[model samples]
Target: MTRHMPISETQDAPPRRRITLPLAPPLEQRRLQLYIALLLLDGAAILNGFCIASWLYLGRFLDETSLLHSQVMLPIYWSIALSLQVYTLTALRRPNFARARAGLSLIGAETVLLFVGFATKSTDNFSRVSSLLGLGLSLVLLMWVRALVRPLIKARCGDAVTNTLLIDDGGTPLRIPHAYHIDAREHHLAPDLSDPHMMDRLGLYMMNMDRVMVSCPHDRRAAWALVFKSANVSGEIVDPEVNMLGVLGARRERGYGALIVASGPLGLRARAVKRLLDLALAGGAVLALGPVLLLVAVLIKLEDGGPVLFIQKRTGRGNRFFPIFKFRSMRVERLDSTGSRSASKDDDRITRIGRFIRSTSIDELPQLFNVLRGEMSIVGPRPHAIGSLAGEKLFWEVDHRYWLRHSLKPGLTGLAQVRGLRGATDTETDLANRLQADLEYLDGWTIWRDLKIIVNTARVLVHDRAF
Candidate 1:
């Protein structure tokens, strides 16, 4: 033990420092696992519920022998269906088109499963008709449940990280002056730093930074260039046109943030596509639902005497005034007394037939013509009454970004309508939530998303969810 060891270069070197990187918090890791596990378990449970309900309903019509066979095979069918649902949930985390594709793929996979089961000469175990019914019901219920839960779960998980930096030379901070939380977090860097290189560095740094706020005047061409450069490098820029100066100097310098510069509007292609879809789908819908339209028109006229259509001035794209169309659902006398007003459930203004039509959303059928006329889209931010601008005045007055809603044609039914945001806006919170949903739809629009909204609209209408 006393023998002196010769110093070798490797052995004599200072003990190698062990760099222990910080692991994610154990609680956080456990939370993530628990959330994922819950989702999977929910999917499995929902699938099982559908299968059991289907079996119970179909069992009543079958012989005891068939019932016994179904009881054995039902669990197998549910297991397969649950697996497909899990696959769909994983795929929806990407893009809207991907989500739609995932939904269709799930349907296809279920169909294949059915065929496989049939080909195996296991037909006696489950009635072919009942199996097909179960499959259809399961797909609709599961897909809808996924859609409803996905956004909620994502919100709960804090998926959105919107910290924008507005860079502007304008003396005022770009903001909705009266609104609280107008700018989440604002900072002014240095007003005198006009050098393009300085802006570029700042922009790049802001992009690299997590959440930053920057504001510059609309006329500050240098700021635009810097923002554009930052957008190119970081690819996380959210340009919300605001009017605030000095606020641009305080822009944040790090992660997951957007640099909002005063630039001319972007996303012209999306606007154009929205218009084209509005026109085409509206025309097609008008043509397809022509007979139903005629019937509704006749019923409205017969119910209220005379005018079968009600027209009112509403805000359209870019805050422009447009006359909106609807089947006359209110008595002319009541309307005249109350002036233009939002119809409430059991509103004294609504005629008996009007109530029925409004409940069924047939009253909105005439707006299809508005889509064809290029004043509206089949799906978009629902137009609001020009006169009903109560709490929205701050948004209308100080926030130019609110005008962004008008960049596309208003819709017959939109992200708001299908998500229980259709009712009367009695409070500021309601308006904010509705507008947020609208903005989300505008930020992320795809043909598939439109189709999903359209499908959801049809479902709501059929079920009399709208009033």
Candidate 2:
């Protein structure tokens, strides 16, 4: 006969192990479906933009001599349209009302594209009025389609739960429903007692299970102690109250583990897809913008007799060092001696051309190489300088959890930048808020999320939110 050992030598006999917890299903499949849906919708928006642009510019097609008739103009218009669409999508991912934000972002994107086209002399082949009308119509149609599709998409992909274990004061087993249909099994284990041996066993069990939850009553000192020890044993312990804010949605309930189950990690496949996307987008952007980059480099040199490209050491994943590149935006004299100064809107150190590129984020184009070099991602938390503090406070003075943002690779643009958290960090509160957004993005990394940040970064840039 098989024998099970008691948790402690002091115990008279081994406690009865009456029940085996059910395994919760994995959520990877469900997350992937949502990602695929978002991609399809985004692709549709791009196609819609192109078709509308083409229809409006068809008058130029009738005249072979028109500039819009040139094959190059077609691709240029398409690229602009796609960029605009991406910008709008990114803005929509944040806190704004979805429909209104999408409309505003689309309009803003189109307006910028029009100006860029005109500046590049590409509009000579297409009628300006026709392009404007096409842009307006496309924006309206795309907004309507998004409104119609968002709920359906959310229904299909949102509210997915992975298997997690919740330990409650009563030590009863509970099952949390899966967010989406998945085949992987999950398990939940809660102990009825607070013995150190039991807690240790639970901790070991959690490490083996991949995910676990522990709940305690209002008088949770003992439970907290157990969890603290468990946390040391394994890094997977989650506070039921703090982390379940969104999931429970203000619902009150008794018993800690009532709503918890253990399932393996979800969204691994989605993460892989996002990495692949970063590689492709970064590679393509570097290739496509080579000429424009050269022109900008020349302009930077002409504007000031300094190095065309500015390189600085920035902190990235794990607080490692990497050289970040940007077109020189400040007079060489005022480059921060401490490398920790933040730029203000009216900072006098900015050069003439520097203000323009900084406002337009053209100054940041050189960092695309950083993305190619794998030192950064196309989207993530914006990196800060090593030894930088939140305002006058030292780095160690702030919450220790603040450094958790460095857990992921830094990005050229990120959730904080898109949300108007870029530019100067005037106070600790500013840095804290930015760090909060960064951590949120890290916790919820996904392909759609990255795309959303990219799109929003463009919109925010055109609007001059940083300045």
Candidate 3:
């Protein structure tokens, strides 16, 4: 018979293991439903306010004019509110923020209605006293309903609006309010990419989590980064050094901190605005530059009977590669597709028309098509060829942050190009200077700034740096 080893005498006794913690239920599905409910409630409050006001003023539940006003105001308010992020996860967690956005949206909508009414000479149709009462009551109801939903949001999302899981793997200590903390050792967890079962365990812990953050020793960060990349979640690694590296912002909460590495720099509204701008300008530029483009294509073809356009692989948004279009400037036989050779003063490979077009920035006109195709932008960091070099090293080798510039679509003319930071990068300093400007452009992007950049670009179309 098998005799169990005595606890005191045995050297191989198994230690007691802690029970695995239960995984937190997914909050995203419930949170979406809550958002829909809040939206309906807001609409109801607006309609009820207008209905009640009409009854108080005209002894009717729904005055024809008042109902019409509510209908118009409702769409306007929703449009403005969406742009202001009134219906976001942040708004759900912070009721005051939601209330403020709602109030501002209402005020803006009312102002718009007033302006339109005056412009259209329809003020007489809308009762001034009734409108005023509706506005006041709408504000009251919006605030009340938002406040009422706070507890419900809390119940659904927990204290943290996001499902945040903090995995401590023998790294820096951190604590965040309502975030699930798991000790890697206790759960027998490791970023073991080779072991399928270990990965399965990791996936279970991160299941339904909106954000998975890991604080691990420097040696393991790479493995964790790879793990998180395929995890289909917003993953962040806790690294305080990102502050020194000029991170966009920081969140300090309950002694827990993280640096946002990979995120969309532009929000939904901003992206929509930027895309609209891109389409308008790119479309217009293509039409306006049609003659110039046709002339250049004929010249390039006539010069050597070769391809009119040169397509080179360049790094684009998310560090992905895309073919960039340019008017073929070099001889077909001597073409450097890899862009390994920087065009210097009096480069022998440049054709006669190529030199003129490059200096005049006319060759870049073809990229208007790239902008229209949504592969590039009118204003952003310029994309570089994969083999492009600074000094003797590649651009990314010069600075690790070099890849960060590709976070947005490469632009025809960027802050760097407009600032006269163009041409071949002969040294590391050239890239550094341009990189600094690109980073500056990435922050606080706006339509006004983009328009300004376009205007400024025209002034630098014939810079000395252009080869």
lDDT of each: 0.54, 0.56, 0.81
Q: lDDT rank, highest first?
A: 3, 2, 1
For candidate 1, what is the lDDT?
Answer: 0.54
Error of 3 at 46 (Å): 5.2
TM-score against native, each model: 0.43, 0.44, 0.60
Candidate 1 Cα deviation (angstroms), residue 98? 37
lDDT of 3 by residue, 20-100 (tens): 433677776687688779888888888888888999999997899998998899988888988998989889878789999
Q: Which 10-residue window of candidate 3 scores lowest in summed lDDT? A: 1-10
Indicate the TM-score of model 1. Answer: 0.43
Taking the tens digit of each residue's C-alpha lDDT, what string does model 1 give over 326-401? 8888788766421235556768877888888888888888898888887788888898764443344433332333
Off by over 4 Å in 1: 1-268, 336-340, 389-402, 462-465
- After superposition of all CA atoms, the RMSD between model 3 and the true structure is 11.2
**Best of the two (1, 3) by TM-score:** 3
Candidate 2 TM-score, C-alpha based: 0.44
Better of 1 and 3 by lDDT: 3
Tens digit of lDDT per residue, candidate 2, span 1-467?
A: 12233232225645543332222333445545654554456445545554565556664323333333223333443454445443332333331344454555555655565687779987576655655655565566666666666565446433332334434433223444531111111222333232323333343443222234443444543443334322322122224453356455222344331232212112355546756877899889989999989988888789878888788876565434578888888899888644666777898988888888888888988988898787788887787665466778644356545545654678888888888887666688888888788768866456777788888777788554544
Instruction: Name the 10 consecutive residues with the lowest summed lDDT in model 1.
Output: 19-28
| Residue 89 alpha-carbon offset, candidate 2, angstroms | 38
